[model samples]
Target: MTIASENTTVFDAVTIDRAVRLGTATLHEAAGRIGALPSQIARITPGQSFAGPAVTVSGPPADNLWLHRGLLASSLGDVMVVTVGGHHEAGYWGEVMAVAARSRGVAGVVIDGCVRDSDALANVGVPVFARGLCIRGTDKDPDGVGGVNEPLTLGDVVVYPGDLVVGDADGVVDLPAARVDEILDAADARIAKEARIMAALRRGETTVDLLDLPKETR
Candidate 1:
């Protein structure tokens, strides 16, 4: 496979599943293997241990009509990632949307804005990561654009419609579709090396010895 570059764009689910199944630690580790870009919402429900394709939505600051539409259009085993033009105040997701997403077989949601209904979301057990929580509601006056299977900007990172999104308590990561195989191999090597280092530690090895650090010149 060709090396994935900054401009390469694709969202192959098969490659993503291979990476996830190789035991890449967590979503955060898999992200690190690709590139550290997606941010965590500080506090949110833990994500399910499943990998799937991403469906992206982008629109005006306070409108979420497109989000609702996107939810209805999404297929099974998809994660709805929304970019609300960086407007961090109004709540873009809540109990109703979560329920709808779950019914559509969506794996979870990652939004660059606020969300509401923490208790309900916890009870439903559908993962949601956002900038924060707020009671401020959004407007139904539909505005802005919605793109299915399109490239979008999320925070400082660029995400394509089908890019692999691996998110957990640590945060969310966007892996380029093309380089999934290479990154998975790298993560496997990393885990094996860490295991050996851990075994040495259990045998009473010091940090300096385990890490091969030079002795102090004192």
Candidate 2:
């Protein structure tokens, strides 16, 4: 059920569901603890959590024209992954955009910038993961430098269109589309191992004994 566009294969629904179930923390660990978005970017709306393929967008600081374009170009179940020069003061997104994203079936939005209309966005029910909330409005300048469906860097991560994006209370993690299957398998194994460790702990085992850590010296 994968869809291809511009030589990129969007992850299928099955893969997205599996990743959502595995969650960002487990997937991040399974991917060798890489692919974490900046800690400043976090789930903004109430109960906000989502997993989907990225629809990458980049725009000039304090401008949102390209974000609109990205939303329009996105398909059902795509997450709008946006980078706006790491600007944090302007409200590049809000309630209106959340409604539009919902109409387009965009699963969520992860922006390395601020957003506004916090209450309305929460009611709109489109998951929004953003850097912060700002009331300063952004300009829809037509001449602003921007791009949609292109690779964009957020923090130290280079997010590509069609890459798997999983976000939750713990924060967002980007997984390479090609490595999703392997990562998921590794996550399952990690979960099983953790379960065993938890069981051992319940049986009165100590972390130093179970994990073979060095003993504390007086």
Candidate 3:
């Protein structure tokens, strides 16, 4: 079984709200594509979405002993960023854990493995993101070293605890805690620019001219 560090520093709640508004796609771009989770990882439910500082967990493959410990260690507004060393078959999480997470005000979960009881999890009400679903259960032996509140490598991305984690229909992306403000500023500019483009579209402006492309005879 794995465990967590004693450190509990979290990102600002207000900043998390602001980043959530930007959405994963926007933050992905704003962060220069440096922190997006693997593409294979997707939301278990269509509308599940949230943003917060991550509580990173690295567990043994095919084992969930670390999951329970991670849950106990998590805090309000914490997003569980679980790395299972790419174990994609076993269902390491399920409905019961969802309920446990919600009781503590945990925002959501993103696992580099599978989660079961999708239907039952709906009742628990915490957003979950994972590679997919599985019916397999995990062994309950919390008897090994696990990493919590530490940096984790999940698929193609590396997530650090306290980094901003955002999830939406587009998928989950982690933004460095230190870069949150800078990226939010960029996201705000992008949003404003899109508003102008949308207004131009409603007024019948062609994409060619709106983007200042050189005029050409077709």
After superposition on all CA atoms, how large is the RMSD of candidate 3? 2.3
CA RMSD (A), model 2: 3.3
Predict model 1's lDDT versus the native: 0.68
The TM-score that candidate 3 achieves is: 0.91
Which residue pairs clash in candidate 2? none
Q: After superposition, how far is residue 165 of candidate 2 from its true place, in Å?
A: 0.4
Q: Taking the tens digit of each residue's C-alpha lDDT, what string does model 3 give over 1-218? A: 33546436577778878888889898888778778888888999667789888898887778887888888889899999898767789998998899999998999999989999999886677999999999988776556557778888876787888888899888889888888899999999988998999999999998888998979878
lDDT of each: 0.68, 0.88, 0.84
Write the number of the candidate with greater TM-score, choosing between 1 and 2: 2
TM-score to true structure, per model? 0.81, 0.94, 0.91
Name the runs in model 1 displaced over 4 angstroms. 1-33, 46-50
The CA-based lDDT of model 2 is what? 0.88
Q: Write the per-residue lDDT of candidate 1 for residues 181-204, one digit (tens) a residue.
A: 666677677778888999989999
**Candidate 1 clash figure, as a count:** 1
Candidate 2 residue-wise lDDT, 1-218, digit = tens:
11224424567778878888888999999999989999999989978789988898888899998888888788788899988877789999998889999998989999999999998999997899999999998888888888887788988999988888999999999999889999999999999999999999999999999999989877
Ranking by lDDT: 2, 3, 1
